[model samples]
Target: MGRVTGKRVVITGGASGMGRATAELFAREGARVAVLDAQAEPGEAVAAAIRDAGGDARFFRADVSVERSVGDAVDGAAEAFGGLDVLVNCAGIIGVDKPTHEVSEAEWDAVFAVDVKGVFFATKASVPHFLTAGGGAIVNFSSIYGLIGNDEFTPYHVAKGAVNMQTKQDAASYGRHGIRVNAVNPSTVLTPLVEGIARDFPGGLPAYEEQMTGHQSLRRLGRPLDVAYAVLFLASDEADWITGVVLPVDGGYTAR
Candidate 1:
């Protein structure tokens, strides 16, 4: 039950979706969780919920796109927890759905600012703490779109691709120090954000679900827990020998 027993974890975007699920699960498994998100109310709620459930947790507000904010929050979490053992880069956005040529520079930059630069900033801030601890783990949330191209969210796809490369680069650079970096590339998960997107789809939610599942070998949308479990495994000691891996959590979406 205690897969990550006593580990100190900092999860970006822990207020919602897969990030929240990962936070809750980590706490249940005996980790001291720091929920970092720009949304203070929800972030606090997530941490409070964990504490209510007899887990150690706290909320830290931070804008991941800003280097200073990320640094402060990461440091704060480490201080609060006495040290850091894991960092989960789950803060991201599904940016504008325009084609690459049609996307404005601002739009592209905005997406990269959150999806790509956020990961870079958070990882940069956590590495020293990890080194101080003698080693740690990092689980980055990439997407199937990062591994394979499609016809939507060009900027998001590109940003995640960069995340995949960064995961490999950091994994290679840090393995000698006992730090392991890996990415989880999930298919369409039915988070509140995705549910909203589905509701606004041309043919509505049912059609959106049908269309998404059509690409997956498993004929269903993913759940937050689906991706959270992958994060847990990567963060846990069971995966001590694993690093530099871009693991696909997709329900065979990439298998096709």
Candidate 2:
């Protein structure tokens, strides 16, 4: 049987990037997928693609920072899937990249809103349902920047750093209840999000991609599949004994 066969998963930000990759992977593995994303077109497109591939999929529009939206999304997913087995909190935005001193209060708040607060809302909304289902797994998205430092990545790092701690706290508090909480911290993975950042950077796209590749010990930037594989393992029963851990899909970048 497939690793996630008969599992039901909810993935936030499932319209694109790592979230989209995770959703596709789960559906392909015989799981029912409910995608929560703010972008309608892409979100629907993903669901349609999954159905076309003989997988069950659904999409919901939600802004993770808002309590109501997050709550509704979680409730809707549980209603549609009969139960929830896994929750992947992958919704986040890097916000405006700038030096710490130059960062605006609004910008800081915005980054915290989606990157940190969103995870909180989504996971909290699903916790009770997970308990009802007799146990569940949660996969949160962190970043290499959370552990390391970078000149222009202040807000993103702060948000991801928070996610790491939150993951541990959730696992410790809920493990007795059969819930497993963990995090996936990845380095430079090529995605639409990364491509957009590269375009707006000082070195431009090609130069930034090269820089991302250069920073990895493997000399190649991480691919979405790399992170997806790790997440799949963590979300599966194979990781039953694992919880509150942070797995880095960093292409060995953190080792340097």
Candidate 3:
């Protein structure tokens, strides 16, 4: 049951969706979790829930897009846990859905600020701590769009591609020191945000689900836990020999 026993983990965007699921799962598997997010209330609630369930957890408020915020938050969590063992960069946005030509500079910058720069900031801040510990693990949340292109969310796809490269580069940079860095590319997961969108779709939730699942070989949208399990594997010792890999948890969406 203790897949990550005694590990200390810091998860960005732990307040909701896949990030929330990863936090909870890590805690359940015996990791002391730090839930870092801009959403104070929900982040606190997530921490409280974990504590209520007899898990070690705390909430740290931080804007991932800012270097200082990420640095402070990572340090705080490491201090609180006595050291850090893992970092999960899960906070991201779909950004403006316009094509590259129609996108404004500001819009493009905004998406990269969070999706790309946030990953950089968090990883940069965590490296020193990992170096101190002599080793650590990092699981970045990229997307299927990072591996394959679609017409929508061009900025997001590009940012995630950057993340994939970042993952590999850092893995190469740190592997000799025992640090492992990997990324997971998730397809259309049925998170609350997606559910809301489906509800408002022209043909309602059923049609939206069908359309979304049509491209996937599994013919169904993902659940947060599905991706969380992959994160857990990458973060755990079982994957100690695995680094610089971009695993797809997309229900075979890329296969097609």
Candidate 4:
């Protein structure tokens, strides 16, 4: 239960979905959590819930695409926790469901800003803190689209691909300093973001669920906690020897 005992962890986008689940799980496992999100009320609620349960936590608001905001939030988290040991880069945005040829440049840029640049900014701000601590872990949230191709997901796929490579590059660059970098690529998790996308599909949630289920050997869509467990594993000391690897939390979808 205390796998991450006394560790100080920061989870971006931690107010909802997979990030929220990770925050709760980390707190339960004895980690002091820093919940950073753009949503104020919900973020504060998440932190408060952790504290209510006798866990240490706090909330920080920041737009990850902005360097200054990310720097300030990360710095504040470190100060609040007295030090930082783990970073879960879960802050991301889905792109317009359009083909590359049809998608607007603005759409592409926006996706990259949050999904790619956010990861970069957060990692940049965390490195020095990690160095000061002598070691740390970084678990980035990639996607199945990042590793494979699908229709109407060009921008998101591109950003996720960049994330995969960036994760590897960071791992290679910082391994000597005891900083472990890795990414978790999940498939069709039924988060609120994905739920919204499902509604946009032809037959709404049911049709989307059927399609997603058919692709999975488990015959069901993934839950946020599914991905959260994987993130927790990578962020914990159990994965101390793992780095630069992209772990897929898909239900055997990628096995085919």
The residue pairs in collision within model 2 are none
Candidate 2 per-residue lDDT, tens place, 102-209, comes to 899999999999999999999999999998999999999999888888886789998899999999999999999999999999998888988787788787977886
Error of 2 at 85 (Å): 0.7
* lDDT on C-alpha atoms for all candidate structures: 0.96, 0.92, 0.95, 0.94
Per-residue accuracy of model 4 over 1-256 as CA lDDT, tens digit each = 6989999998999999999999999999999999999899999999999999999999999999999998999999999988899999999999788888899989999999999999999999999999999999999999989999988678999999999999999999999999999999999999989988898999998899898879777878899999998988899999999999999999988887
Q: Write the per-residue lDDT of candidate 3 for residues 1-256, one digit (tens) a residue.
A: 6999999999999999999999999999999999999999999999999999999999999999999999999999999999999999999988888898999999999989999999999999999999999999999999998999888889999999999999999999999999999999999898876787788888987898798889889998899999999999999999989999999999889998
Using lDDT as the measure, the top candidate is 1
Q: What's model 4's overall lDDT? A: 0.94
Candidate 4, residue 191: CA error in Å? 0.9
Tens digits of per-residue lDDT, candidate 1, 129-188, equal 999999999999999999998899999999999999999999999999999999999999
- TM-score for every candidate vs. truth? 0.99, 0.97, 0.98, 0.98
- The model with the greatest TM-score is 1
Candidates ranked, most accurate by TM-score first? 1, 3, 4, 2
Error of 3 at 61 (Å): 0.2
Screening candidate 3 with a backbone cut-off below 3 angstroms (N, C-alpha, C), the clashing residue pairs are none
Q: After superposition, how far is residue 127 of candidate 3 from its true place, in Å?
A: 0.6
